[model samples]
Target: MSRSGGEKERKYESDESRIDSGIDSYKSISRDPYWSLQSSEEKDKSSCGTEERLDSAYASSSLTVDSLGDFIEKCSISEGENATDSENNNEEEVNLLTTVTEDGDTILHLAIIHEEQHFAHQLIELFPRELLDIQNNLYQTPLHLATYLNQHSIVKDLVANGVSLELQDQDGNTPLHVACERGFWDCANEMIHNASPNKLAHVLEAQNWRGLTCLHVATVHKQRRLMRLLMKKGVNLNTQEGTSGKTALHMAVELHDVYMVNLLLNSGTDVDAAMFNGCTALHLAVGRQDAAVANRLCQAGADKMIRNMEDETALDLADGNDDILALFPFDDIQIMGRTVINF
Candidate 1:
């Protein structure tokens, strides 16, 4: 009977060991990271059966299991908080770059206007190409500001990185127009030589609000070298100004610039291109009593027969100057009731 009792006791001990082994396996699965991924309600539902078993099997271990659950919950909350903070940080960074001031100037605009070259460089690299063309309150883009400020390096960088060359500021002036107007050849050259053939063509033809192309600007500013640079790029020699319908050649003659006159003539300018008042360069020359200019126009194949709005030809405007009248090949000239001989 004693030996039978011993066998039963050993069997009971083995069964208890099996119970502990199963509980350890359950605890291991509960500690899995996969469980941490579940929602709080799902985790509670999943753990309910295990929790009831733990409480029934060992009341003392219930506290331990509850503490472990709490630890995981805290960890999950901490991770979520970190994730939210990370998102906020990323948004703030983007806003820092994109935010505009009351003047509608972006950080990049201010950087350039303030002559902060180093900061501008950093911003340029950080900004997307389209953002490089953003205009401020006055409708001036970064490129416009750069050109206006004569920032040659910035202009080069902006153009090389694919900023839109056609964007106009408040005055309808493109960056190229500003460069030309200011005689900033370094800035102008960067834009002109770096542009695609089609784009350069379009820009050369683009006019400002004053109805002046870059060529006209160069001429008005007496930027001879700049004018030559433009002409070399295939600018339209006979493009008329919007205000007066006068070409660059007309302005050159009006400015009494013999060098410009010769330059335009050699560049195939329309010698007899008329102005708004139906006046040709020769008409203005003869009216100004500039015999030398009249002679030059005559030599360049100027049509002296072209009449002005005043119903007068270039010959008619040469009132009494034999030197002016002599430039035309008229054998008989009647001027101020004087019969003159043409040379």
Candidate 2:
């Protein structure tokens, strides 16, 4: 052979040797003695799944070919192993063993996201522990995820499995708060009134990173029924968020949610509670040019003379608001000219 050919053969030999070494190294480490039990456990699933797949493969292949005898033999061996695992109750126990992802999600998390009720049931039957305590990277628990996704059955399963009813997320907000924030009225009601401790007072008034309470979220989502439910649960209508120092009524005004505003007012929320901005709900109504809100506030004995940071009164806020004046009767608007024009 030529010298170049000899060199090429040598190099090829070296590369093949390195490749074989790498393969061996990978198998050795992956099946390391230190992880013998785990490796053994891992093989059971992979081998079983492969056997199942092969069984299906043969069944499909039989449609095109005459002989599935060999495939059937292989599948029979696998079926025997599956029977053994089943008889030993390993299958039930294995499925229930909680598996946490790198993101801290339990098997329940995967079930909820994938809508795998069968798989979820397997998990539940195995562990039967609430395991709802597992939090995702977002710092929300399984209940929070289920509530946000509106997974009714999963919520029931989790509650029955013993997940703490008052479990709070990193933000100190509970699952009920998340449900309310996401407009999952049924989930919220179920969590609060049924499965949970009905500590609605704590949850309804809980704040998120923005210091917005459950009522604030409900108003934004126009979840009036949830609002009524929360109110019936005795959520303090006047609860003020620390960040904005805004009451639920102020939040309603900010959202321009007429229904929520009416609900809040009817619930006896202090319509006059001033926020950190020193603006009352009345000022918000006047600023939004919602004369109906303005009229409602004034009729409800809301003092328009309330001052904000700028020391401007609600009447002074009416100067450029033609839309707001449009809400009042023409005669009322004209007569309100007697209203003080502080601006």
Candidate 3:
């Protein structure tokens, strides 16, 4: 063979030998528990299998406690081995805390979802503080999950540990918003009590993606207790939503929720508050043909002559409803400085 050909053959053999050596090294590392623990990809793959086993284990009623115990033990052993090495231990615990199911739920997330308070507490204690706020694929922290699930104990634990109360989920909903929306009064109250004064104010006023504050959410959901709680916390009753530019009073008027309207009005909500389109709460109440609500608005000092973008007053919108028109006598319904046109 030519010298060049022999050189090429030697190089080819050398490349093959290097490839084989690399494969053998990978195999050895894969077999080593410490090395495997350090491999995120391997841990992820194992997490998938572990979740499957968990699901199967949970399916059989008899295996529930035993399976959880076994799983917890396995996780504990992995965590215990690295305890002496604080940095590595933290990293490992973070990885474990954030190890997700197919839906990107950590074990902590699952524990909350399943209402396993003990397991959730254990995970909370084991995970690092920063990891407590680690978001799942949906950007939901453990606090969000616990609040959504109405897990009071878990919520309390998370709050006591200083998990972020104002962290927004994917939809820009804070845990407080979730609690109000879900009608979890206890959870909502817990959040309110546990939050720092500054954070409490921020959370109460914070708008979700739809631009609804906790007050708006309470009003929309007709959660009277939640609304009262927010009010006690000094939530702005007239805070307008981004989408409709309507305050909680506007929503209450539109929904014909007389009690909520009164609640808002008595709490100092702007009775004459207008939307982006310049439609006031009175205009909406009249449009909805809610005579009681209209009466309440008028009593609250809602302006009768306020014109919308269309230059229409509440009376103009109420022209078709005799009951509403009757609320305002002919003299009171007339626009100032204009000839009275009887409806």
Q: Name the top TM-score candidate.
A: 3
Cα deviation of 25 in candidate 3 (Å)? Answer: 44
Candidate with maximal lDDT: 1
CA lDDT of every candidate? 0.75, 0.61, 0.73
Residue 157 of model 2, lDDT score? 71
CA RMSD (A), model 1 = 28.0
Question: Sort by TM-score, best first: what order?
Answer: 3, 1, 2
Question: In each prediction, how many residue pairs overlap at the backbone (N, C-alpha, C within less than 3 A)?
Answer: 0, 0, 0
CA-RMSD of model 3: 13.2
User: After superposing candidate 2, which stretches have Cα over 4 Å from the reference?
Assistant: 1-96, 125-130, 170-173, 195-198, 320-343
Clashing pairs in 1: none
Whole-model lDDT for model 3 versus the true structure?
A: 0.73
Pull out the clashing pairs in model 3.
Answer: none
Which regions in candidate 1 have their CA more than 4 angstroms from the true location?
Answer: 1-89, 333-343
Clashes of 2: 0
lDDT of 2 by residue, 7-42 (tens): 445434443423112112323433344433333223
